[model samples]
Target: MDISQESGLVWTEVDLSGVFDLDVDESLELESVGDGRVLAVSASPDVVNNVLVTDNGVDWAALPIPNGFSPWSVDITGERWLILGRDPTKEAPGTQILFSDDRGSNWTELAVELGPFDGTAWIGNAIVAGRLIVAAVQSDTWQPQLDEALDDDMAYEPSEKHVHLFLSDGGPAELVAEFQGWYTGGHGASDGFHLIISGPAAEDYLLHSPDGRQWSSTIVDVHVTDSARNELWTADPTDGRFKLERFEGVFGSDQVLTLPDGIGWMPDLAVGPAGVAAVGGPASPNDELGGDFTLPDISIEKNGYELRYNQPEGGITLWDLNEDSAVYVFDAETLQSEGEFQGVSEVEDASGSNVVFHDPETGAELVAFSGEELAAAVTEEVSAAYSEYDPDEFIIGWSTDGTDWEWQTPQEAFGLPESTPDDNSFTQVQVAVGHDFVIAMVQTYEFLGSDFGEDAPIGVGDSQSDSTSAYLTTTTSPSPPRWFVARVE
Candidate 1:
């Protein structure tokens, strides 16, 4: 499970069995707790149905679930833990909101229900500017044949979408603001909550919530596809056509697009310090959106994928499942296609002498410019590539030109031993590096055998599920992990 990429630096895995109770099989989702400690939320059972709370990633504690209904998600704010879920019984109309104090030792349930729309409720919460704001879709919108409800665009309110907001409190999550149509994505920034919602269905829109209670909407906004440098990006979706716009503190600016025109079915958009690129769309589209500035066209499967901007150089790269695990790279400024790079390790910077990417299926490491062309390389169905338990080894490499990489292993680069990693246990590592501190989250699957998810259900109510076995199952995807924080010089 090791990625051939070598980060020559030393990384130590601190034991957080104390915080996580040694449950390696749980799908741990990590969030920084303003304080020195980290806030971890994990499943109460083998599946991602229940949730547990941990402060230090060493010792853990359980939260109170009122109706025995598993929580859908928990919102971690500067001061509170808001666990949100739906009551699975007929008595409660489906919605449940619980508020917890600092250590999650106690919880209070509020009367939050969707009334008539119980079956169609999809709720979420995010900490915005030190406040807790909750968003819910009250429409049972869906397509009968669709595997995922989120993709059912026809199910959404064509004329308008309703987005409800709730403020953080002790007794109940107060419903504050309600807007039209459904909110697609929401991100909390310091100014407020930046939300991308469908306006009049398919038209573009942006929402700004100064506080959890108030929301303002802007129409014909930029269709932001990715976030970089504290700002969001999207090809201009105005005039019901394509153009590129960078969303700053506000919307509405001159189109930054310099790509060709008449591209059709453009699903994904990406931008970097260098330039912008659009993928997928009509082969010959009317130049209604492409004005004078021609933004180059970067082609890939026009559906179900997005472009990732390589930082430091602003090059664009994406994995094309249709292309048989092949990764295509395009220059940022010129938008010309670079050859496919497959199965190396970490993404190298523009200046690195060695560039590395990995084979999506085999987890095989391929060095850049090693004369290995993996365009449509055969291995396995690209869909089944990596999972939560499948961990890859990461390394740092140097390349004189970021495009071609002559990767260096830790032993070769820093003179470390061949076996210098923290352990043989395979799990994902999410590291947050600061000026002097680093929080490395070491994920493992050892907890599947542990009794972590086999315990009694958390809720107590007449509406709770009677079958305790319903509460436990095999661990879910993206198995959770314990957090280990250290300082780096």
Candidate 2:
């Protein structure tokens, strides 16, 4: 929840109970909001039959059925939905667009050509302006890979691919215009709204569309052999290594966010209020090995931060919030493989915030993704762990690293404290880590029970008296002897 940033220190705290339901996914699918709250759309091809949303981070609501495929893209205007789809297993004719007026609670189908040709692949939003919705969709015809598919030449059926820009009427999902190769991945907010596509047998290209209809495409001149591509993504341009070029008049185009070599892999794109945040996977040997198990890097945008998660073949998921010092690296085998990350909490009291990421150097603006931060202490370590919560008593705790954790309360460190005879209760708890400090903030309540009697009651309506209080506690994570960071002074 706490990530360090530039300017020495920058903090953005969000209350995440307002827009989410407990059945959401562990990962976030980013959505940008122009006239309303940002949404994080979640769809699990393995579990849930429906898609849901976490608005800004708090409220959780199910998206109305868009009946196209397992994976889909969402674009919201005020309360309208622009949903897209393409099924990997089914023929392309099944890919259709759906719309909704009442959030995702209900929906209406839009006319889209579902084809017998297996062409449509990745779809991206290029621009949203003045009631015009511009997007890029890729199409390729590949014959099904047989069970004996092994050799590189035998693995794929070589076919021509085309990337097209589709224009819509900005009402219910309707296609108004189309531009065919500029194979754009998820578009970035650089320059205006720049839609980037990895070119065939040449350098990747960036297509700029302001009104979401007319666009100018430019080849980036970064070349790669036609056979080298296992996947393509839009990376965080500031990292400096990935050849993400700068194009004028595109979103974030005024400034460049570079991708350092050996740092990022397949960049999953996310956009919120901040700007375009592309999170990439780790640069690993397995990534270069060219297999079906290649774990792609994941990135999402939100206000003030570009969040990324890396999933390697045999590792945990690691999240690095750009310029934010807290890099949460977790056991991916547990979080993702074991399906822990897929199990979103059912706690309804969570909230979300709209994140606006600004290019620190150029001050260029872009939106990031929305997320939910629950009131539970989410701990991650290199071992097996468990957490317990008492809804009736409003208490919670967890453990991972060891038996004697300095992170819990006496009630938590041990079990629940012995109930006081006078009836004392604790409530409103919070924990935080500061310079050499672990702080616990809380409030208390005390009540005096009335005298019990079968026939000697002074009055028919006897009650207990009540009092309230508040306080804080500080401790060490590994107990006092273990200093997290020793000071030289």
Best model number under lDDT: 1
lDDT score for candidate 1 against the true structure: 0.41
lDDT of each: 0.41, 0.37
How well is each residue in 1-489 modelled by candidate 1, as lDDT tens digits?
A: 232332323444566554455354444444433223333444334433244444433444555555345565555434555666655554744545666665456766655546645235555443434435455544544435444454636253223336666665344567776766656656454556666666555665777766656777777445433311112333335553232222232121113332222222222222221122222222222134332223323322324333344421446565555554435565555444455433434454554444454456776543342112222221222223323222123332221111222233323433434442443222333333222333445433322344445343321011111222143335322245544443334
The TM-score of predicted model 1 comes to 0.43
The RMSD (Cα, Å) of candidate 2 is 25.3
Show how many residue pairs clash in every candidate, following the order shown. 52, 77
Instruction: Please give the range of 10 consecutive residues that has the lowest summed lDDT in model 2.
Output: 459-468
Per-residue lDDT of 280 in model 2: 23
**What TM-score against the true fold does each predicted structure earn?**
0.43, 0.38
Which regions of candidate 1 fall more than 4 Å away from where they truly are? 1-9, 22-24, 45-72, 86-95, 101-105, 116-119, 126-134, 142-161, 166-180, 187-193, 200-204, 219-427, 432-436, 442-485
Q: Give the root-mean-square deviation of each candidate in angstroms.
A: 18.1, 25.3
lDDT of 1 at 127: 40
